[model samples]
Target: MFAVSGGGRGDGSWPGARWREAIALTLETSTIDNTDNLEPTPEPLHAGAPVRPDSPTFAELGVHPDIVRALNEVGIERTFAIQELTLPLALAGEDVIGQARTGTGKTLGFGVPLLQRLRPASADAENASRDVPQALVVVPTRELCVQVTRDLADAGRHLGARVTAIYGGRPYEPQVASLQRGVDIVVGTPGRLLDLAEQRHLVLGRINALVLDEADEMLDLGFLPDVERILRMLPEQRQTMLFSATMPGPIITLSRTFLTQPTHIRAEESDASAIHERTRQFVYRAHALDKVELLAKTLQADQRGLTMIFTRTKRTAQRVADDLADRGFAVGAVHGDLGQGAREQALRAFRSGKVDVLVATDVAARGIDVIDVTHVVNYQCPEDAKTYIHRIGRTGRAGKEGVAVTLVDWDDVPRWKLISDELDLGVDNPVETYSTSEHLFADLGIPAHANGTLPKAARTRVGLDAEHLEDDGRSGRDRRGAPSGRRERSGSSRSGSGRSGSVRSGSGGSSGRGEDSRGGPDVADPATDIAAPRANRPPRQRRRRRAGALVGEPATDERIGSAEAHQSPVPELAGQGETTRRPRRRRRNGGASASSQANQTVDTQDAAAS
Candidate 1:
């Protein structure tokens, strides 16, 4: 790539000229365009689902006045391409498959209609009490479930739509209580939604509309079976709306199987690519150790507003966010490791400009539609082209200019090459660049003498310290150290408490004060006393004395077998010293060796007890 000037996208042209091209691409001049069909008023299966006459605001799209006021309350007035296309059909009760890139307002596309149909503004728009949710939204991830629910709730504020979000890693009591009280709409991850429906807590027989948000993510997460099972539970006569950034074969099959004569509508996208037109992409071959250094410099670039950094794993996301925060950038992280409340806290702070940089793993980043994100940094190479598009799409949203930088480690070259070939990005071998390299400064328009750290004076005043997040009402293993979400409901941390058999543990499970999990109580061991589910147990305290205690034991193999049989069936009780949420460590060798090693440990423990 030859570049004549600094800040040029290799051709000495900034995104301003190209942004016009994007506007032209997304905002069609003709008001009569119907996307798949050019007809002004395309006929639908239902007469009630009518196409509205040309008008500027959402009110003209058959959205109710109260809901329109709610959209305005959130500072959203005008409609986007997807909203323009999908709203009319959806409001009229027509099935729709909306395919588009992320950040194109797909939430409002289906949301506007879902609210209008479910909570009409006439008499019930302001009513508080509602029975048996009329709508259900199934999403891929917990983060997305919360996001969609929030968006819909915001949009339905005036309409009094009781939108509730439910997902795994959360206690079932709150959700069950909400369902019992009755809700107007429920947005949830597939697993939790299915669970609630089966328990008869979430009724689907009366569901008027079902939304499968982010179908591609659902497929990637292997939730299609759950999705199919969920769809099967809904009323056959209901409206179905499916939205995805990409439409793969499985998604197509799902649509064919579940949707009834669904009309495919796309916005802010071309079938050739899902990458945004307003984003300038740069791929660089950077040293793995020094990628952080490069990222620090990039964050200092002029106009680098609310940046997003993508990592492959949950651990990496936390590490990067911590590293950036230490460098004096207002940073927050989203990943599986953080509690739901913490994740939402980070996202909210980022959205409010209290934190301008968001570090995230792909699982937690789906359906994150924050606006004004100026950059997306791929801290790790994406697995495929689809993922790359999704990451960078975080920036350049709603037709704004954004810069996407990918720091490709040497080992990731082959995978990067594959993605580049698939997307025709033309940078299969990214520029061999370092943190202090001139090309980096020239390409990103970084100020001269900019180091890998921010100046004390340049640090933003609003940071994570200045932001406050609501509790997610989580406890124990799933809490991930976040404050509880429902404090009023948390008068007692115990939801459903029952006593099982008295638990017995070895000396390894003793507390520092000389009491064990099963000790006769002068004071009961809090761990066993709580009697919570194994999945919600606290971090164990066993590993510290494991090898020391085993060396003193002398029992034979037969005693180990007997001890193992008498051990608690709940795995948490057996290993009361390990964190409940983490996976059980597998041995380095094959299964037979692992079994042998396990038997030896058990034999040693049994002998020590004897």
Candidate 2:
């Protein structure tokens, strides 16, 4: 049996006495069963059944009353399976390895305990004066960083716990300034967090708790080295927690090396499928060129709200979004090719109901948790089963039913079969379907008369342009359609040192440097000094000279028509005190002629005489 005593202050007036009493009673009565009998597997704590009326609330789990109140205010009273298993061990300062499927409320599972253990800024004078973070949560992607920061901030609002998010693609000045102002918890990606820590801007020496969320994703993205470096910098006595959906080999080794006697908890049953049972999935064989037409009809399905379309490449994501928007559908795109401001703008538009369709690539869509998503469409076949699971996991979240459709081209049929076999999806050979196919309409609940374009009456939602893009303080070169990296030649004057020389600008022309009224070098105004047109300029003349004297008239003259007049003069060679022209050699039957030899002998004699 495990037990934890809870109290906020040392004055003996227990602030969480009711919750502690409830936790003690539950721990005493409940019998925790070890579901997995495999050797080397830690005893797993199961929540038994899904969340119900009799499920334990945050208060009953001995969570801080302030956190419980904040969670209740947001209509989150009962704990999910993962949260129920994690809260007790984590709140007691024990290291925990939490494994759960996506959208199983993993953020709050660690967030609540992390917030409860930390001393809030308003309450702790010593820690507040130091302005060092008490807890750190590291995520793999920028999207996840934002999501976790928002969740933790909402959960710790009543406790006055300051939370800040730090990630790449945004200006560093703002994040550094936020850290300087002090925060109770910091949630960030590995790259940006390590950069700040190496620069001495972030202080991790005083951290009391550390969490690596999405551990498997971090390993896949090759962030384990930076994560390990960060872990080494923290105090050794602090508590560590790791949460991931899948446990690969590297993650298991990581848990063994860093975590101390950690309790392994799996929220779901052992025999359960990796995919959420509530999600309804369908697969179809589609053509490469007809994919857009097929996806358009899928978006028009009955009762479809906030659909997400996934593509394999960044170009395809943007292309699908453009095609949909051209067909009068409100759509936005999130991919690697877009600027950070544009990506955030698309997500904001999608979340605010401004855009009903969002097109995104795999990496860009990581950690996006948008509720109310009724449909997820795979515009192209996924690479493997894991990607397929992650893609469909976006829908069917939080115990909601969702519809997922996959369109596989002829070339990707083999890949799709492999994924189907791995997951036991039983859809090995997909039905060959097209935009006009009757079964597609029946499967996804599309109207019988639906076409490739959206109707005028259904285009009521505002488009992506309606969302105001925030200025991320990036240079114009970072924006799309902006000028290249080369600086443009402007008419603005530039001051130079007091010297007399031609000051050449980047326009490939020399600007005359003259004295101004103040006796300083005058800068040229490019706007007023436009070059003359070629037609109006005088024709250039060419003259021939030999032996330091003009030998022929201007070559442009009509009188100079003979071949001899057009011949080039021999160049004069400088001797000791005389100049002699070298005679030209003539090849006659691949040998020197008698006249050429005689001219050469005369030139040599002339040089010897000088």
Candidate 3:
């Protein structure tokens, strides 16, 4: 077995075993009240010592002149500690493992070398003629894939490098088409990239550089198997780079297996300077039912621009968005239940200031780097310290100040305690808080007379309805209403009779709560249900009413007429001759058929007369 190594803390303990034990112990101690504020707090990034004037520039760090010029044009003159340390070694084409906190410019640490190694001048003319990928960057989420792809494209604009981002929640055709046209770099999530490779749409045989971005988060998400399969497909002699926020044992094992004599580099903020020093954190004990009211009150605080609220599940995300919208807040929701189009729309609206508030699930919020996010509210307590860090990291980015507010319900007190202990966020026992609590106003700087209601003057400039989102990332066939060139043949041909039929479910019907937020096959996005428009398919179902209740639903009074219902029967149309419809019996047998009921009533009356 490979020799087990601890994270640079030099404790000499097996990192994976230690991490697992820590989680187990934290969970066990959840019910027990332990010491609070036991750990000293670190300084924020801003309070750290300034960078030296002699710090290396992109040009001094072996970056190409064109890349240097592009960086200069973008106002990025000096490199961060991680970039300065990793660039020279990376430029030398060595396997590298980079460890740093989030928002520390990890992308450029590996991305620059990945692009430099793919230069046409470095390869023969004949070899450069083929349109195939020379570099591969794997991330854990589509949001990260898009981000990495955009950054690389911007940096390589003068170099003529073509980057393609592939992920799920999109049709396969656009990706396949992009692959056919040939791309220089392939940035994608695990599952979609693997699918294209297995289907022969993506060729990885010639990749010169392989970068695994956010490797720890990838492992946490159980993408290890897919990562292994992908690594096996690449050439053995390729340069590899692994970057993660933390050095867990599993990530170390992965790096050992993948990297050939890799250089280990860790460039973290000063020990006294915490990665999250710029963010103010507030933890409050809250009642589950009253949390919404508390959230509304918080949103109404002064200078609360671009707030992001994170929930544990998609159901909560939608419910929160709906509740906020009901109160006239410009809100949008990103979750698994939304289609790719809807997800993208929500993100765009949030970014464009059309929607000031974005409610999202943990998975949906991954790799979302939105600057100017003044506050992050955890609608539900996070499951772990890493999750808590990521949720709060959304705010206080780009060297700006931010606030993170967490409302922990009684049931989640233990979980919150574990997170607080791990992160050393000194909320030993959060003060009990309600919507009307005076502490809420004083802590977050809300107006003394502020109610839980949002006023028209407080609304953002635009709402989600005003924005028009175009869904180009998805394939033509699956683009909802968009036309496509190649049509997908789902199965063997079958015909259906065109008939007018009642909906599967009536409007305002309740749905079964069995489906979780991650969305399995059974849980279809009703808004983008492509099957609805098919010629032979049955009429679209009512909003959510079950099929069985349509014709048999009981009324308060059984004999109520059209006048009592405040409606009249349909009149004969011009095209069709006069047709009269009869009122049918509600049920059969016990609730007898209409004809049987009429005959029985006459027989009973005759017997009574006799």
Candidate 4:
């Protein structure tokens, strides 16, 4: 993975063009667009009267007037639903468990409270020169850490709160230096958090407010033990806020183990609300290789200004974006290999519409809130329901109708079915399709057979034909078409031959035939049976009868010799109509073994003919 900057290579050529094309083709072909005449918007649905704070202002949410002024300066006049629900409780120093989806103003839900809780360095001279962070917000991946830290800094700018992010896959010295410089809040992933803790470079003992953003994801990554250890190191009286979209058993277990009887604020997402009301849910079954194609087509449809694509892997994220860019779609990728600066640059381009698509892995794209993301394509169906929700949640933000297209591989049928059932999203049986499926064009609102024949610039943004894929020889798999839409194996890597567990059924040799033959019993020969026809049987009769002619009785064995004259091996005289070939009789030998062998040979041929 080459380091990319400014959305292009140093030479000014778009480095992601190949990837853009690949992604476009995968998504466009794989997605099955909805034809259900359901309009995009529905009615408003909220649990209670919109929570009305005593003072309907930021200052009433325990935010210092100076902080409120700072927030107001940034155009944040009123608190969002999440901020209103979580701020009052957080300001009161109570542990909180806030359940909300992405793009729901969750950053400020915890950020503002944490910033408000900050206290100037203690008067102790011994600690005045030393720098130890008082807060830690642990996220799942590096990209989210950077995104979260930036938001926290922006919200806390006037308060002069120093926020720092430390995540893995980059230089450690800078993080250590940042720690030395005394950051007020440290946001990072589990591995780096543990590393820094063990190195004694960052201390959490004095942490007053510990926020576990996207807590379910941290739990999913097997970081619960680390999270527990980190929690143990913090002050016993510290406030712990666990936030996630969907709560699972493991997360609940963690909350029970660590968080005090927290305020259980459940902000349910309603299909009738503006956010959920306008979100369009489309489900389709398609070949795995064709996902990028399907997405390409969807992105090009309706001129939806910006889109974010979610894939299950970093490699897939890169490939999806690269495929789209190659097709001339202004696209960029955000994942682990990129630097914070590089990731930010790509995101800026996407937000500004300079780049229409941002392909990202689930972990990398978390906490990234880009408004009016017209479409969010799950290039690959997520591993489970929670992930599926998060991937699509990127779109449908800020009360705008957004489209989410999920491309399901055939193998993912079971997994996606479970998600569909759980979410009540009536789309469980995805249509089996490939890149060439006519339905794909209809779904994208593109004319069938329009591929490649369109103007180059228009085609670049979407609909790549099979002729453009790079050759990396592997096996008999078709490169020009979409993947077979088979489920990807859990640990099976995608090789040049493509992912495994493919079903092949047609005319072919059987592997078990040889084994069966080796163990089977042999059959008996009947060539020399005394009761058999003498050397020959009459040619298979094709009898024709006169209109009034009578048929004769069949010949008996006793008269076989007389009738045998007509059953000659050679053709009968020209005047004769038909003849039967006589089975060659073996000359009898005095030796039983020789005679038996000859009879066996004759019987084998007779059996074959029969």
Scored by lDDT, the top model is 2
Model 4 alpha-carbon miss at residue 200, Å? 1.7
Residue runs of model 2 more than 4 Å from their true location after superposition = 1-50, 120-126, 269-277, 476-610
Candidate lDDT scores, in order, read 0.66, 0.71, 0.68, 0.60
Mark the regions of model 3 whose C-alpha exceeds 4 Å error after superposition.
1-52, 270-272, 472-610
- Relative to the unseen true structure, what is the Cα RMSD of model 4? 22.4
The global Cα lDDT (0 to 1) of model 3 is: 0.68
Best of the candidates, TM-score? 2
Question: Model 1, range 283-361, lDDT digits (tens) per residue?
Answer: 8999988989999999889878888899998768767776676676777777765555455556666766777888888
Clashing pairs in 2: none
Local error of candidate 2 at 275, Å? 5.2
User: What is the per-residue lDDT of model 3 for residues 433-493, given as tens digits with 9 covering 90 to 100?
Assistant: 9998998999999998777678767664467656544343433333322223322211111
Cα TM-score per model: 0.67, 0.74, 0.71, 0.62
lDDT of 2: 0.71
Task: Single out the weakest 10-residue window by summed lDDT for candidate 2.
Answer: 492-501
Query: In candidate 4, what are the lDDT values of residues 1-610, reduced to their tens digit?
Result: 1111222222323222211110000000001011111122121111111223442568866688767876666456566666666788888888878777655566777888888888777754444567578788998766567667766776677778888878764456778998998888999888889888999998887788899988877876778888888888888889889898777888877777787756566554553343346677777888767666666566656556678788888777766655665555666667654434345545655554555667778876766656566888888889877687667766665445678778888888999989888877787898776666777667756555444222354533321111122212211111111132221111111222111112221111112222222223323336545567765776665432323432232323332233223222333323334533333344446645433665577688789999
lDDT, candidate 3, at 502: 11
lDDT, candidate 2, 1-610, per-residue tens? 2233332332333232212221111110111112111112131222222455666999999988998887676567788666777888899998887776546677888999889888756577777687989999999887778767777776777788788988876768889999999898999999889999999999998899999998988898889999999999899999999988787888977877888766666664222232347678999999988989999899899999989989988878867776777687888777766655566767777877878888889988877777678899999899998898878877765446789999999999999999999987889999999999999999999999889988888888767667655555544233231133422111111121101011222321112232232223445555445574566767886665555665333323244344333333444333323444444444564697645665676688789999
